[model samples]
Target: MLSRNQWLAVVLIGLLVVSQLPGPMVHSVSSRPAHLLSTLLTPLSQWMLSAGNRATRRPDLLQRREPGEDAVRQLRAAREEIRRLQRRIEEYERIRHRFGEQLEAFDYVHAAVTRWSGDPANPWLEINRGRRHGVAEGDVVVNYRDLVGRVVDVGPGTATVRLITHPQSRLEVRVQPDTADEPARHHLVMVDAVPRRGRFEAMVEVDADAPIEQGDIAFLHVGEHRAGRGWPEHAYGFDVGMVTRIEPDQERLPLLRKRIVIEPFRDLPRLSNVTVFVRREYERPDDN
Candidate 1:
């Protein structure tokens, strides 16, 4: 009788003897076993080689790609910076076009408003420019042709501004005819601040036939009265306010007078920046 180990060894010896035999019979017997062994071992060897290559090169690939990502981030930041600068340039160009002949007469300084006072009726602003930056008391502050205020107090690098809404502020203005062809008329009037209202009112003494109405625009007049009023000559034609309401002046008789309530073209509390018209050094009388 044969044991299990003895039987396995006798079977392997018989297969080897058959593989070495001559003729087509031996190849036919060996072909299937040889094909099965080749199929299994070939894929295993290839998978191990591919995995080892990936493990060796992964860190190098990440290191090589880091600088490219950083450059992309830096490019985005630079584009944003360029856009900001272009906006500022376009703004200054628009201002120059609007106030062309006027801006040529004096040097101007741009200042940033740093603080807004709580009182709207007597609103004031603190700016980031002062005496050292050529800002001075009485210098007119404006956003284009819209009147802002005057510098009241100045330090080495800071200054305070009083807005036109203040109760003490007054300006002489002319309300333009709504239409150009409506026969040119001088609608001259004096605008005064309305206490606690943060606005101005002009009372006109006119006959019942006066042509004043709502929607008319008022502009600061440039005349002999402006010379000593701490206002620059270039600020003469700046916009002051617009006629918002028209009603009868009951205190003076409806037939003889009317009240024209004016509202500023720009809201004071929203001011963020202003241009100060600084006196030219060469034209200063004291310098001569």
Candidate 2:
């Protein structure tokens, strides 16, 4: 028997009280009303949100990309590819110019290092080339002019290389005085691996005034001792590393020789790619 306005006020008050009830009670008591209200207000809510976004100058990111934007992205990618190729070409050119005569005797197989193994003191690299790609067990792996390691195990699709830093590795190397006017006096030394240390150590007796500096390079000595080794004859003069530190050999009573440390130009553990030297069948002594 209440007026129409009084009935509306009562209903609104009831709705406000129901909204404050516990979620479970409100859900059970007003499921139909909630569904109908949501359905009626959804379009209006969406329109208000869109209008706000437009007012803020925010574009809809879910929309399809424009044709011009796609073209620009493709063009940027193509330019990057060209730059990468150019840099690779420059590297090859530098290698050819530096080791022209030495590289002519053998062919190189490119390989990507896929994994590393062994303890830190005696680590090894696994490359993605195997017998199928002419990579033999004794094949020498190198990064440009730096001697990396020797292949020890080979599978059909992969090969493992024992790095030069292995505890058992030893190499014959030579260092020359830093004098340019005088004849190059080669200081021959046998470098041995130091356990747990990723460097080579050698003892050489130098005159007090000899110009052996820290930055002097150590080159692999390829003579009668290494003549029969599995290494390619062309690898005779590759760089081993630079002289990092020199200290007096205390173990020696007279202290006549100094112990020098040689570190590779590149970090062996961080190598991503290497080249394998594959010997060709039948080589002419006079070739190149």
Candidate 3:
């Protein structure tokens, strides 16, 4: 356990003691004791030297092993983060391509829906765009294939929109009857109003003798429902939905307001991207 310098001093003391011994006594001691000392000291000296070498080399040797493990872990984490970001970029590219073709037909702003109201009773969605993106409070929002909702509130960087499933949503809708070769405009009707108790559906009150069926296609905003019977009339029209479930109320047969439920053309909750028209499009002369 002695240090290197201490071991050297011990060796010097043994040599001094040997020199003081009488000549014949030294020779007699060397015959047995010297051999014993050689046997003991050889391996002990080698082991001590080996331990000292390891101690002196430990600082650099330990530095490489521990830091090597940490570096590997950090590299693996950085790779995973890069993969995640690449996936997000691919998603944005797909969304851009899908929204491009339909947007060409109209003057509109695109937005990504960032949030949703889980309540079917008061359904809504939030878009990561606002007035700064040219989206006004009353702008119409639609997926490429069909209507989604209307912008209700606007912020600097975000906007709140009311989806059609909301209890208070009342966009005018028109249906094409089953057996009618009649022009699309002739069959237009204001959707009968009802309390949105559950599920997404529009109750259309039609005549009992009318040829309206369960599979008829429907349109929204085609004709102008109400500027509240007092406000200025605005022009807005778009393809809305289709008649999926029809129930004729026997109690209202004489009244000719038999109710039918219209399901939207596409499932609204599944839509991720939508275009919001900045102003009511007055392009359709018939809508006037």
CA deviation > 4 Å runs, candidate 1: 1-103, 199-208, 224-230, 285-288
Which has the higher lDDT value, candidate number 1 or candidate number 2? 1
Which predicted model would earn the best TM-score? 1
lDDT of 3 by residue, 26-137 (tens): 8665544533443354445435544544454223211222334477776765564465346434533544454444334346778766555657777776676765566666
Candidate 3 lDDT score relative to the true structure: 0.58
lDDT of each: 0.65, 0.64, 0.58
TM-score: model 2 vs. ground truth: 0.56
Please, what's the RMSD in Å of model 2? 25.7
Model 3 vs. true fold: TM: 0.52
Candidate 2: count the clashes.
0
Cα lDDT for residue 253, candidate 2 = 36
TM-score of each: 0.59, 0.56, 0.52
- Candidate 1's residue-wise lDDT over 151-262, tens digit each? 8766666667888777777777777653443436547777776644443344444455567777666777754566444566667666676677788878878877777877
Best-to-worst lDDT order: 1, 2, 3
For model 2, the stretches where C-alpha displacement exceeds 4 angstroms are 1-105, 177-183, 198-211, 224-230, 281-288
Over 127-174, each residue of candidate 2 has an lDDT whose tens digit, in order, gives 777767777768788988778889986765677788877777777776
lDDT of 3 at 235: 20
